[model samples]
Target: MGKTLSGKVVVVTGGSRGLGREMVLAFAAAGADVVIASRKIEACAALAAEVRDQTGQRALAAQCNVGDWAQCGALVEAAYEEFGRVDVLVNNAGMSLLYPSLDQVSEAMFDKVIATNLKGTFRLSALIGARMAAAGGGSIINISSVEAVQPEPMAVPYAAAKAAVESLTVGLARTYGPAVRVNTIRCGPFDTDIAKSWPPQVREFMAGHTVLGRIGDPGDIVGAALFLASEASAFCTGSTLAIDGGFQ
Candidate 1:
């Protein structure tokens, strides 16, 4: 593993399990002190212990509800207090709400998806970008989905929200230039709990959707994240790195 992130401090939201968990370990391996956040404090704490045990880096776990601005503000403050500063911020907390069609989706469900995925990302990025500007500069990575571009018709709400995330990535990069870099990673179907929640047949069909002919694993996302978090992507900003296996 490369130590591209040596001495860096990173904040990863939803860093309890799945992609979020993988990012925490990956960043730790890259020699960064990491702050892990999730709604479940216990899970985040457990992951933090694992990071410390395995990587011997400073690790912190904080309970956070990303959709709440106050919680997001406190999360940033706590991370800075623990690590002195944050050089990287990964907006990795998101959820999907699927329905047959937009017409069939209730207003509440639509609002929930929008709030958690789109609004949460905006709130966190705004706070972090301000801090990064004040502190010179930093990088922000937003986790999006290929579904945003390809459009899962039945999962309109999810697609719409993820699309908004992509838009926010570019918008923030433009608005906070010279101080903060912002980008997004668009991932394809993966063998994660989020995908497992689908119907068995649907899940099986998704496995074949990728040209790679298999669902991606959590590790598949780590390398790209590490590159974005490090100086490797010093010139890259306001772009979407698609980790979809030729699905686009």
Candidate 2:
């Protein structure tokens, strides 16, 4: 069989690092031209070069802070100008700042968390989803979190924002469906470059909660993303997929 995403154009925000980076490479490997966006243009450009060299897929790097609604529009415009159409949009950029305590969380920190996680998802989905709707159809994958439903201490604002992301997934699905599809991936802790900084004990504790008995490997998510991005999921929409290794 042919590659599932061959000839597709995929735009991935936060494409410079973590799971987003993995998905960018994964999609490119499946023969998709990729547009990678991050606040750091240099990092995105570096990844773009790597995608072109490794997969021979066209790659464009755009510096876009999705938190800024304007940047989201510009990013989409650039992608369309370069590729004519975007077949998939992965709303994957997010951040969680640690505060010493709930009481210590400042207005700025809370707002930043919400803006990055929630508002950014909204802008991207609305902008690209509308375009997808108008252009017949496309797939939109929102990277939510297990924290959205299972909120934890120290990242309250982030959890709240991701909770809103799940809501966005359903709403966008309804608004754009019949052609366009919208979905969410509720991610669990994963073993990525970011996890290298996590304390060893915390890693062990997280492992204890999963049926798989370990954190997700970076490539573990590629199958789920590809399924949703391709015709294999033609009947699925407005769904929140838990890519959390059956967390308990």
Candidate 3:
């Protein structure tokens, strides 16, 4: 069978590593031109080169801090300048630091989490989804976490922000429908770069909660992503597709 996502233009925030990088590689391999967006231009550029070399598909590296509203606009402008239109948008840039307690969660930390994980998704989806709606149709995929619903031992603020992301997906789907599709990938514990720092117990705890008896890997998400990004999910919108390995 032919690879999916042919002739598509996909923009992946946080594309420098982990799940984002995996998606970029997977999409390019499936014949899609990809835009790699991250706060670090060097990383994005490096990945862009790799994508081009590996898949021979056009790739653009654009520096963007999804936490900043203005930066989100710039990213969109840059994507359009290169690809003309974004057929798929993956809101994957996010951060959450563990603190001793919720009381210790500083205002700055809370705001940063909300801005990066929630506000940025809102702004990008609103702008991109509107344009996609106008230009016919496209897909907006938000990267959330299982913590959004099930409270994690740490990163409460982050979990809250992610919950809002899922809400944003449904809202955008309603607003931009008949053309644009907004969906959320409620991810579970994955062995991404950030997870490398997690203590052994925490890691084991997460893995044990899953029916699969393990967390996910970067490559595991590509299939669901490609489905949502391509025409295969034509009937889906305002959907929350969980890639949690059946978290308990």
lDDT of 3 by residue, 1-248 (tens): 25688888999999999999999999999899999999999999999999988889999999999999999999999999998999999999999987999899899988998999999999999889989999999999999998899977687899989999998899999999989988899999999998899899989998999999998988999889989999999999999999999998
lDDT of 3 at 2: 53
RMSD of each: 1.3, 1.0, 0.9
User: What does candidate 2's lDDT look like per residue over 34-137, in tens digits?
Assistant: 99999999999999999999989999999999889888899989999999999999999999998899998999988889989989899988988888999999
User: Which 10 consecutive positions of candidate 2 have the poorest summed lDDT?
Assistant: 1-10
Candidate 1 lDDT score at position 19: 96
Model 3 CA deviation exceeding 4 Å by range: none
- Between candidates 1 and 3, which one is better according to TM-score? 3
TM-score of 3: 0.98
Q: Please list the C-alpha lDDT of all candidates, in the order they appear.
A: 0.89, 0.92, 0.92
TM-score of each: 0.96, 0.98, 0.98
Model 1 spans with C-alpha error above 4 angstroms:
none
Off by over 4 Å in 2: none
Sort by TM-score, best first.
Answer: 3, 2, 1
